[model samples]
Target: MTPTSLNTGVNEKKRSEWLQEVSAHLVESYEVTESGKNPIKRVFFEEQEAPLSILSHVWDEYDTYAEATLHWLYELAEGQNFEVRLKVAETVGQLATYEFLPVLRKILSPWAKSGKPSVQRLAALALAVVAYNEQEHIAQQALNLVDHWSNLKTSSSLQWTAIAAYGGYIGLLVPEKALDNLKIIAQSGNGKLFSDIAKAVEKLFNAGVQIPKLHGLVLNTLREWVDQGENTSVYRLSLLIFRGLMRKSWIVKNDIRQPTLLWLAKESKDFEDPIVYLMRNGLNLGSRRDSILAEILNWLEFVDRHPTLYKTLARIIFTLAASSGNERKRMCYYLKIWSINSQTAIQILNLINKHL
Candidate 1:
């Protein structure tokens, strides 16, 4: 045998061994202890740190071995270990590139069609990541696959997954298309599906996926949904979706924040639930706490004008204050310095002391 051919065979054997070793380690690392926890609950909530670390190391060390690595991951993905398979699916999406499109589709397609809802959802997310590829054909294939799964005839679980995947990644290539699809979906009046759709919007903002006028486009679409006065389900769902966006409002550009908050405050004037939800959860303000607090303070003025909303708003504030000393101090400081000329404001202030 030729020396070169012998050396090539040796390298192939070594690569195969390495792939097997890494794959086994990943699976072992992710093996969850049977802690008497609900199997489904454990599957979704358990942290698989060791496997994630090993995967990160593998990528750092063997990025050039893309084909072999992807194949090994695919094998693991098809394995019986649910945790490892889920992480592998995520890694496949994370590493998606134009060159890997064929294998990525191969790795994801079966899972996308799996009878298991969890498997389908993970595959949908991986497909969304694939759609982020810059090559139009690669991106289009991923989008089409997800769009196909989103058809009305599909299982509701799979449909929700497809809609979420589309919502999360379509903006990467075509923001306008994403907005249009989302608006249409929102207008469909599928009350249960809106939560998943809202999650997708949250994922988009969390990933910092920028599109010009994203806030305006989203808000306008929501305004239209809310204005369809006959659909109370649509209205409630729209507010819930708006709450999700508002949590991430701190990440939005400064120039856009004020107008967005103003619009939200105006729209929210007649409703109490959204305000209660926000106050209970608190805003994700990062470092812009003061600025967001000021905006929320401005919102409180609307609560002042609407006497019915005052008790609930005040109760939420009282609950928040009672839960944390820092929150209590913060609420007190803001309420004291702000002009509390209105009667509702005074009543809310009076409620704070009762809670303390």
Candidate 2:
């Protein structure tokens, strides 16, 4: 069975006529709904693609027809076909602007409540697209959904869908509350959720919105991740925020202190975040790991003073100097420390220097 009826089972002429009807309404479509048309099925699924043509065609007619068609747009979700559903979602996503954000939000409510994971996911995806479209929704609807979606769970494919969706949420909405939620999720090290959240935040920071408030939110969120329980890879995100923050001169060493300390502990021998697969060994750890020097210094100090953790500290430092980008800063810095304590540092230094 087909998931959705893209063709409306109508002849090409009928479909073409329907498309023309919608195209003529233009801005007047919203007025139609206000005039009490209340069309339950708002979307014209079969007539996707050349969307502007259809929209323009209806634009001159009764705007009511277009405005009332939103539910029909959402009904595309009812169709079990992935292609149809996604296309419908994409179409609605296109319509997700300030004028229609509330309608989009209403359209998505079904997925929020429905047990069908794909439907819910498509809803999220639609919102992501909406967020990306600058002329569309200002992001409030998407922002609201991100928080709503964070606490919800689904299948592996859904998780994959979520990975980028949540990222888009942060990137587009830039809502402080939603960003805060992401921060907490990242900090919790909810092993399952962090990777997705961290990855998303990284993408958002790179997407380039010159909102200082958003920038500060991103930095603080990273700091929250560090304090909560960040893994090494997560530090990649932390560093991104850190680097960005550094340029703004908004975040200082005080900001780096706690998160950097947590990152150090992750590199420490006993308590590493579950995702540190890089320790498996490869080439060198040269310029690539420049930011890590600050972390290595913290680890060294923690271990040196603790004495009990000296062995774990030694292993981490040794690992650092041997990794792909450890040549100048990381290895050299460690070598300096070893030079001071030739007795124990010599052996580990020699092995690490091999990589450098």
Candidate 3:
């Protein structure tokens, strides 16, 4: 026999033996129970390692074992336990290799149709992971599947999950295309769909995934929607997204923040509902409170004219001040300082004190 063929045969035998040993160890170590406890949770709740850890170690140490581990995970995903299935979906997603795409597709297709939001969301995320593969054909296939899921007319729940998954992964691959898709989705004027888009954007930022021009693209799109005044749902949804972006100071650039505040000021004139909603929900700005307050103060010239919005902003500042002693002191100092130079700030300080 050729030396190369001889070596291949020996390696194949070793791989088979190693896989067999790992499989046996997994079966013996982790017991899937009727209690529906996720195998992954065993590591935390029972303080014992589970088969997932062993499979991860195998996949990491031995490249050839990746395929075997995926197949094993696919089987585990079919089990009756909901948490186990969700965890398996997550683990498969983290694998994020082209080789896992076919198996994951098989596992996720049924899940996409399962009519369970949690299952569908997990499936969406797992299926989207294939977009991370470097192979052109594989990534295209993943994108195609997401497009199909998002376009499913009969199921809005499925569409929501697909939008979220698309939001999470597509920007990493094609920022312009992602923005275009989001804009088209927004045009549907479905309020729930708009919420999913906002959530997807929040998920993208929360995960700290950097995509060039994506933030600007999203901001511009929302600005255009608010500017058009064609759809009240879109206008309201845009404000919701603006609030989410503003809460994260690092994500809110000066250019974006200025336009957003302007939109809020303009919308506040006619739409107290969305404006009040933004104020009540958007106050968790953490350290960005100072900059955001300063920006709003800059608009005191305009906001001072709108009584409803003025009162809402004052209440939001009061809510921030009441959150803690440090914040109260900070707000007190800012209110005192700004109150000297601005009538609006003085009014806000008076309003806040009335509440305290």
Candidate 4:
């Protein structure tokens, strides 16, 4: 039979009652046992997963329950279940609040020094996410972790994961020692560590954190990556990092203009995605819609140098032109200015226009 209509049936009440029962069961099941056995029974994996899953949903619903979720997850991490610890650590990164910094730091301290690579990596990610905003309080902690992991003699996995976790410090009040450690990683050319550094900086940028100091460091590193001969992963990662930095509005476009333009000229055609992708996610530096378009406009002079990029730019303009939105409209208008200046761009626009 078809389901009863919500307005006619008591379905809402029934669902609410079911949810209440489930929440109660989850709490009872997750509570610490008198016998000291992990509250999660290995035989009932789905039942074991329920509490953490519900905790995730609770955190998503509001900030009021975040501390309770953190506390519960910290308790769960004390269990011997590998998956439970890993999942708990992962979830903590998302549900963590600044008020629980001490709890998170305590949970991470021992894992940071774990002998197991798997445990250490998971802990590193947690440490980075939890310390992301409160670098001041954990400045010494992060510094010590970076130094300890960076100097580890044996295991690249542990070292790289540790470095990546510290990536959370992108725009925060990091110590000089931390920056020095990052510089060493950047210059090391260790593929995993280098990529992790890029990922960390990217995450920071995406969080709307800005650090003008990373400009030169990133550019120099990008140049190094370029000279290493077009490793797609590294190239893509470097671009993501560049886009993040540029989005922050602190990277002096003119400083890396020549190198970047030349790189695009030689490599734009091979850049996996078209210029549309690049234009689509332009930085959100200003409150106004047109600000991003203006930022894109500033780069046209450079795009003008390489006719190869003109066609790509024209396609981007055409694709964006059809959409009727404030940002799209502004983008189309500025794109026209660039499209008209170059014959190649104009040709591409005309070709696309004829089909429409």
Question: Against the unseen true structure, what C-alpha lDDT does each candidate score?
Answer: 0.57, 0.50, 0.58, 0.50
Off by over 4 Å in 4: 1-110, 113-118, 125-138, 169-171, 175-180, 186-194, 205-217, 220-356
**TM-score, prediction 4:** 0.36
**lDDT tens readout by residue for model 3, 41-75:** 23332223445566556766898876676566656
- Summarize candidate 1's per-residue lDDT along 1-356 as a digit string, tens digits: 99999988777756436556545322213333445322331222234454556655766677687568767766554434665565666677766543455554666665655656566667766776678766777777777766665555435655666665656555555555654565556555566677777776555444443553455455555565566553455555556666656444443343333223334333454333444334433333233355446555655776565454455556656665676788788777777766455555566666786757
RMSD score of candidate 4 (Å): 17.3
lDDT of 1 at 58: 66
Deviation of model 1 at 300, angstroms: 2.9
> Comparing 2 and 3 by lDDT, which wins?
3
Over the stretch 1-356, how does candidate 4's per-residue lDDT look in tens digits? 34557556754566446656665422223434566754542323236556556666776677787666555555555544566566666566544443345544555555555555455666665655555645555444544555776666465655665665655542244534444465555555566566567666555433331553443344445544434443444544445555544344332233343323223323444331323333343322232235446544544554566454554455555565554466454544554676766554456446555654
* Per-candidate clashes, comma-separated: 0, 44, 0, 0
How far off is residue 258 in model 2, in Å?
30
Indicate the residue-level lDDT of 315 in model 1: 61
Residue 73 shift from truth in candidate 3, angstroms: 4.9
TM-score of 2: 0.41
Candidate that would win on TM-score: 3
Supply candidate 2's per-residue lDDT for 102. 55
Selected candidate, larger TM-score, 3 vs 4: 3
Instruction: Pick the winner on TM-score between candidates 1 and 3.
Output: 3
Poorly placed runs, candidate 3 (over 4 Å):
1-87, 90-105, 205-209, 248-356
TM-score of each candidate structure, all chains considered together: 0.49, 0.41, 0.51, 0.36
Clashing pairs in 1: none
